[model samples]
Target: MAGRAKRLRIHGRVQGVFYRAWTVETARGLGLAGWVRNRADGTVELVARGEAEAIERLIALCREGPPAARVERIVVEAAPDEPAPEPFEKRPTA
Candidate 1:
């Protein structure tokens, strides 16, 4: 399968709203590999790598986050191409 990766910075009500957990579940469901974590600036950051279709689905889900999250904007940048072979995770605060 074709593979792609992206780094996403999600703004607005993305922190303290189960965003990380939601992202973990979403990524796992889509068979993506990466990690999601909360930024110090109250945003949520995630690096997802997987099939093109799965990546697109993950991005679409980020557009409308968990029930408590009110995502304002999502900025996605394509990664420099790499192989990812792991399950999704919610990394500790950094």
Candidate 2:
């Protein structure tokens, strides 16, 4: 797709809360292209590429993630260096 990309590092009670799976579903539902994975540092990381508005919507939704998630904050930044992923999937824990 011809859209922008953003990298998000979500913090706080994110791991073990099905955050990655939730993210995959959300991203795909938004018709985004990217991947989501759990990090070793107890965070959820996502690289999403799609319409800027869609990406913004995803970020807003992530602030209030799955029922079990207690998202404290998210670090968002441009990820123009990242190649867009396809089909929005979940990746192995990093």
Worst 10 residues of 1 by lDDT: 79-88
Model 2 scores a TM of 0.95
User: For model 1, how does the per-residue alpha-carbon lDDT over 19-44 read when each residue is reduced to its tens digit?
Assistant: 99999988999999988988888889
TM-score of each: 0.91, 0.95
Give the range of the ten consecutive residues with the poorest summed lDDT in model 2.
78-87
Report, for every candidate in turn, its global Cα lDDT versus the true structure. 0.88, 0.92
| Candidate 2 stretches greater than 4 Å from native | none
Tens digit per residue, CA lDDT, model 2, 1-94: 6689999999999988888889999999999999998889998888999899999999999999999999999999998666677899898989
C-alpha RMSD for every candidate: 1.7, 0.9
| lDDT, residue 43, model 1 | 85
Which residue pairs in candidate 1 collide?
Answer: none
The prediction achieving the highest TM-score against the true structure is 2
RMSD of 1: 1.7
* Candidate 2 lDDT for residue 18: 81
Residue ranges of candidate 1 with Cα displaced over 4 Å: 82-85
Predicted structure with the largest lDDT when compared to the true one: 2
